[model samples]
Target: MPHYYLHLYNDMIVADEEGLDFPDLAAARAGAIENIRGLICETVSKGCINFSHRIDIADASGEVLTSVSFGEAVRVDG
Candidate 1:
């Protein structure tokens, strides 16, 4: 198990003080997406969502592994 941090970046860096344990990068990525979805859902309920915001998944050493945008967290059926 490895610890990874999920930081929110929307003109600022909202760092996660306590990192989570994930088996690997893929798992971390999925976890980040799931968490972001939950956050977006909450924001959507208030009718306030900045599509430009993003979640940055990073390693313990301040290295960004991957990022998920607010727009990507949503699914719009057209």
Candidate 2:
């Protein structure tokens, strides 16, 4: 299993000191998306959230694995 760090990025970098363990990049990515969803939900309850927020997932070596935008993680059905 490999370790991955999920950082929250918008206008600044919020690093994740403690990373998560995943079997592979695919699994890590899925986990990161779920994290983004959770943040989006929290923002929704807060009344105002910059939909431009994003999640930057990196490997243990600090290399970017993937990025997910807030708008893509959640959607309003209309």
Candidate 3:
């Protein structure tokens, strides 16, 4: 199983730059949510931001993985 890392920003995830890998899209989404949960919590705790935002999913090649819509889709233009 390839490890997926959800690179998060203050606003939204860098869809085009993020790289995630999993046996399926559902798993990837689950992982991404888990990863971002901490960051989201911290941001809220500091009163920096609210609303759980996320990006779809992008491959290592910077291609938008349409199967996932949990956030902004990266590499969509490409």
**Which wins on lDDT, candidate 1 or candidate 3?**
1
Model 3 per-residue lDDT at 75: 24
> Which residue ranges in model 3 land beyond 4 Å of their true spot?
1-9, 12-20, 66-78
lDDT tens per residue, model 3, 26-56: 6877766665565555665777644435544
Tell me how far candidate 2 lies from the true structure as C-alpha RMSD in angstroms: 1.6
Clashes of each: 0, 0, 6
Q: Would you estimate the TM-scores of all the predictions? A: 0.85, 0.84, 0.53
Q: Give the poorly placed runs of model 2, Cα more than 4 Å off.
A: none
Write candidate 2's Cα lDDT for 1-78 as tens digits. Answer: 899998989658899999999999888878877988887777779687776888888999999978888777777688
Q: Extract clashing residue pairs from model 2.
A: none
Per-residue lDDT tens digits for candidate 1, residues 1-78, read 899999988657789989899999989888878887888878778888888898889898989989888888768788
| Highest-lDDT candidate | 1
- Per-candidate Cα lDDT values, in order, are 0.86, 0.84, 0.52
Model 1 vs. true fold: TM: 0.85
lDDT at position 71, candidate 3: 39
Preferred candidate (TM-score higher): 2 or 3:
2
The TM-score measured for candidate 2 stands at 0.84
Error of 3 at 66 (Å): 4.6
Error of 1 at 16 (Å): 0.5
